[model samples]
Target: MRYLKRHRHVGDPLEAALADTALGCGFARPVQHEVLAGMAAQVPEFAGGRKRALAHAVFTMLGADLAHDDFGPDAFDVDALHPWAAVQVTAAKAVLGRAAGKAPLGAGDLALLASTQRQGIVWEGNFFIHLLVLHALADVPGMQATVDEGLGTALMYQRDDGGMPFVTDTDTWSTVTAGLALHATGAPPPVLHRVARHLLRVQHKDGGWSYTDRAQLPDTDCTTVALEFLHQLDPYAYRGPIRRGLDALLAVRGSDGGFPTYGAGTPSEACMTAAAVNALSTQGHLHHGIIQSALHFLVGSQLADGSFPPGWSRSRLHTLFRAHLAGNHSFRTPPPPIRSMHEQTLSLVRAAQRADGGFGQQDGSPSDAISTSYGLIILTGQADPAPAARATRYLLAQLRPHGGTPSPPDMLGPRPFPYDVPVLADAFALLALGHLSRRIRPCRAAVPGRRHSGSRPVETDRAQHHDAGAAHSTENTT
Candidate 1:
């Protein structure tokens, strides 16, 4: 509470929480030191390689440094540069050079330039992309003007309360994710309270939430996250919303007993199902019939390599970790079926580990920060600390000077969309480190009702019956 008074930045409190927890838990290992040393030595190489690659592409395509105007008239030829030349030049010399061009600019050329610049920074059509592009193009002169304009445009999407939506007019998903991340970091009470109120206010009449308040159709993924966040904050206070959300989760169950991301007709997905199980377990719905069926689905869905099929993320590690967490929470006594599933999942994750002590999205892929983080989270509470130790090392190696981690490009959706959000990578790394360190404490201030009890309120028989009925109905229909 005292720390809350001093910090106001959206992510600062969470970062501090993680740092403090890691320090208190003594999560650092000897292996991590060696990894850090090696990474320090490799930093110049990595930075140099990136600089070279970026410079080569930029120079080859644009000719003459956009940073400088040393290139002659031929280099700035609008005809030769046709499409590219149309892009707004930010450097003083480049602007002047373009202005001095004799050929009148065509509308198509201008349009092409505008689109290219937008794509370069805002390709995904999200405000966050604009911020990333601003950081990426910070050194390019004249680009500042474009960045400033883009920033204004991006700001237009911001909600009145200053929270940013992934896109304009949709705040639930982003808010929930940010709140959860902040909660994991031990964010201050007021900040979390604000987030909680927003989520509660946006809860749909059907007892679930979608990606946005505008999208009235409840999805399993967002609803699960919302329920989990509320449960963590104050289960008793939020019992009403929690019950409604649980029912909504049950309503979307596939005939196979697994939960789907969207509506009933949609197929069950590994990630969504895992999320459902975790959320349900959080609220003491672990033994419900629907959960049992979901567990069966998860076991049946495991690939030969021990990985689950990908859903939300391209990284198998993502689904594997989620499923592993689900199993850990869903099973009270570690039944044979769940235990076997856990072993197989752990083996696959361990196998995916690289010699560098990090994990990849899958076997044969290069190790990355996000996947490595997921691996650490999965292995942290297990019997062997070695895998988690190695993963912590791998993560330490990826930390940037500004305290963020950069992961390689990854797939976001069914399409080939590359999700290169560095900030998200940082958040996941912090979460892994927090779990690995075992320093994260429950938020007593945020959820004072359970602060003294330290026990989750039990689910009522009525809730269990409703869940069973929903599960049975889904099975009959499908």
Candidate 2:
């Protein structure tokens, strides 16, 4: 791994990717802000950086999407990104709007970086917001103190290269995901064992996990995926933590029989419910009672076309496929309706495949590694292998000597704007490839000297999934 990283030459993508995963224990020095930095720099005097249309392409794409989303003016659906993206866009435009005197000066008008702290992020979690806050507050009065603090927080995520990631401290989240991908392919290294053991040590008292070790708050999404990793690492060894995690997950169930991204009393979300059912049902008899209701909630929430309600993921297939796999662990025989939804979802996946054999966030959108990975995960083990095989080849073609491609961001952060978690694309590709390998040649993983738990990967609260998750094992992804 050191040889390739230092020598800088073409290498086998999978070997290089897995080597990267193992050495880092699955963490990546995450990056984002092509669009955002462009906007921030465009703020005229933004930290003395000049304006550039760095986000021109994405702006065009998102703008085209707004026409379909109705720009959400008459009504805003929080789940569908109505006002969230609108808020960011408004703040983004205010950078230039301020110059033409077109920007609104009212406090509500600026809506800058929202002082509201979602439980998902620590003050340090989202550095991009602090930078945008500076852009929005560029000329506002009585805000010097806030600006100073915001700049300090923003700089925390800055790299020596002078670019900053949208978020940081995703170490725990990245570790589990990278571990799962490697585990799916084969036994993970002892380094991952060390990392997972630490995860166990930090498991919240209530049996949940936050995205980072630095966070005090634990959400259902991270908790469930963490449990999946623990179980896959070694069910018996981590039984105590897994059980506590299950209890924590159940504690957060909404009245509708679904789970939410965060804790109890939050509204049940489609992807979260699906993930809860997947992780809970995997352990056999123990969680069937819980799974039934959550599965019901998820199925009821499904769109007529077989996709579940959209949340954190940009692609419908991301949650749709994970929900499909999660429901497979149905109590006894699957109910006719539940079985039918799985079939329907599978059909949708088949339908959504592009001519290139890869899948995209939407049927006609350009293909990307992240969404394609989710598609392959669901398509694997189907009666037909053609789709999954083709997708696999397409994915491999996209991988670079450095082990990544320019996959579009599928996850939403702080609501609607896409935030890149670069490792996810690689992790999921590894996961999908593993699934395809297993489907074609059904080889057993030789249990190594070390322990591992988990029957699978997981899906997200949104544009996220593990083959074993398609994954938060539903919806806001890590």
Candidate 3:
């Protein structure tokens, strides 16, 4: 059965197809990789302490996105790492560590490894890259354990009917992500077989996968994930499905070569285009006419700041807060971001670079770890230490020594409540600290298990600021 039947849409078929496709994708990849590769090349040691940590984050995001495409959302969320996910990360690290026969793995090592499982604050896709990095950084034993656990989870989640549930039957995005997670974690062939059977049947006739199993009503994002997952599972196994999916994806691309979130004449979407390129390339379909056009489209659309605009439209949290306060709580869907031609994508990212040495989420968004980390990954796999250092200082300043991170009053812009500091933020902060520590002598000496020689934990008075929900305690020693 199809995940989202075409009948469910009241909008034009083209609109439904495009919108559905967009939801299945996120921040585009060619842009992300281009930025990351540049940063890595610029930095001599991409995998060294801080750089390594940042690389871990980049990969983590990619892994999380890809795996979520394979598994479902329930498997992991962005704000907090699930205990089960941690076990899987830990297990994968353990097994991999043994494979390498390295020294005993440490907590930082596991954290570093686990960080690769990317679930941003919203549990959006992009957590699998973290798992991949976790495997890369983990000792053989640790890596092996991680892989085993991931595989086991994939097996446990498999349905008797062969298809994986997207959380609980209605989530095609979840199904695709869960499937990818299983593959990325290296599920056994038998399990792969069951999933493959299911994906094929569920795939839309138009060469894509969507909320429902149907024809011409597929989404680009979900299709991208499915294509990549199948490529990883067994390249030749779903060749037909892959071919059709790519074609449908290509059909949806605008004249600018970028794919829009919805129908023809829709604006180009940076994120969707990036994801489309990555998915197509991963599936060995990069040479396709549509794929080539997409690549050119993205390169043309590059921002001067070295970052893409929100593929969907930008949202002002301040505006949202005010609306909520006024009791006009209706959620409005922003229009799709305009897709750019090849040269534009490159120019956009170049333009988006902040003087502070990071990419902002959007032109006016705050320069926090979340945006910086994302920008760094796109511009350079290694996060720029400058922005990271600043963010680190800001994060530390927010810590009350006794409680959660809070937004200072002066920083408010209509939204006065404390912003939620996501798990990814904490992960990024720890990573930045780790990187900065390596550059400074005293800080460098303060690796895990080592006490600060001269500094002592200082006593501070508690403040009355509201907590940012489960304010992730800087509990793990910085």
Candidate 4:
């Protein structure tokens, strides 16, 4: 560690020390430390006459990741870090997008970054997960203003009930989501204080959050998302509450190391576990023995084509409807279709991700932007032209000759939720476009139309729907 200081390799000495401690504790491998050190050496000290503090944070986080791997006797697997490469690719595009004035790395970019679940970010406890990722990668000259704007926009979605009203104020899921987004952008303390209080009061005795504060017993999705939000908002600030909540979560961890949606005996879910890993790892808790086993479980479960199943989301919706009926003696919402054809189909497609880049959500489905974006993130930074090209082709096909889709509904799969297509699908599409823009070098600028940019600023009143049902714990506004 002193060697860096002796050479003045150009970062905070304390950060270097932390990286050293993490590495020496076997958090990362010796070879990775060395490789990272080499990269750090290349990191010019005030060379551009101004330090890339943001880029430095990126390297520091990666360095810490190395240290956390426990200085493995087995060489560091470059493949495992593939996600970072893809992130870097997107980051580069974010830089380009910002420069080209295509779109600031706002909601769409935040969603993409949030999905990464990387470590060492200053979470600020807002709704924008990508903003946290951007904090480390935002090296572009005018990024802070964009951050401010994004924060303001995201904050506007917050509800009096302390949830982000995705389309309507009743959206508990998006409320917590909005809180995380605001935190990601480093929102003001006053805003975070309100969110924190809301989370605290709303948290169930089981240490999780559901549709409303009263919907107690805990669902893995909401629990994981809530825990992640708290961890990011103030890792140190909410340690006790977070740990208590995580304790409840730990009780549900399957012997296989993966987490079950409701109970321990059930088969493990990849997405739940992945979400759990993201939340836990972000809090520097990835070293837990259970997490290591869970990582093994996830890695082992990857299909031949390199994707995991739709575990949590896969529980038949009819079962959830029954559970909700039995628990409340009444149903609050209409019963949705049993199988989420699009979602379920996407799972199969994800499992079949091609080495070339495109992936199908189902075995036979054509590669599309949605699946490709997910696969690319899952693969990290690896170059997979097949998935990339196929996804690009799908997005292009959706275009109405005006460079944007004419109507948001046209791009939507058969699902009752409106936010899915806009936030989830559109975000994926934007990310895919960013990737394709780099890979194919499109002749003209590509901007997704406002037709689907979220029908109402995401903060207004919206219809009520719960595709995931009671068990899935979805909290969409409309």
Q: List runs of model 3 lying over 4 Å from the truth.
A: 1-170, 181-197, 212-216, 263-266, 283-289, 313-478
lDDT order, best first, reads: 2, 1, 4, 3
Residue 459 displacement (Å), model 3: 40
Q: Candidate 2 on 1-478: residue-level lDDT in tens?
A: 3543542223322223323443443322231223244234212131111112212212322221111111223222223332333344445545544443553556765443456233334343545544554666756777666666666666565667555666676777777777777777775458657867888887889888887776656776677777777777778887898889988998888887988877676567777787777678658677667788788888788878877765667777768866876766563356887878887898888998988889988655788898999998887746666787688878999999998756877776543345567888888898787666555533344345434565443332222122432221222221
Measured against the true structure, the TM-scores of the candidates, in listed sequence, are 0.56, 0.67, 0.36, 0.39
Q: How accurate is candidate 1 locally (lDDT)?
A: 0.59
The regions of model 4 sitting more than 4 angstroms off are 1-170, 176-197, 211-214, 285-287, 312-360, 366-372, 383-478
**Candidates 2 and 4, the one with greater lDDT:** 2
For residues 1-478, what per-residue lDDT tens digits would candidate 1 score against the true structure?
Answer: 2342233332322223323333343223343334233222321221322222322222223223223224433333334221111132212222333434433334553334344344224433444334433433443444567667777776666666544444333357666766666676677888888899999898998899976675545777678888878887788988999899888888878888787776764667777888888788775555577777888898888877787765666477878877887777654567898889888988877777889999886556688998898888777646665677778888998888878788875435211123344556766787676555442223323333664555765433221112111221111000
For TM-score, candidate 3 versus 4, the one ahead is: 4
* Candidate 4 per-residue C-alpha lDDT over 204-301 given as tens digits, one digit per residue, 9 for 90 to 100: 77676664442333666667667767776677889887987787778778877887665555556655665566556554445456655665555554
Q: Which candidate leads the pack in TM-score?
A: 2
Worst 10 residues of 4 by lDDT: 409-418
Q: In model 1, which runs have C-alpha deviations exceeding 4 angstroms?
A: 1-171, 285-287, 439-478
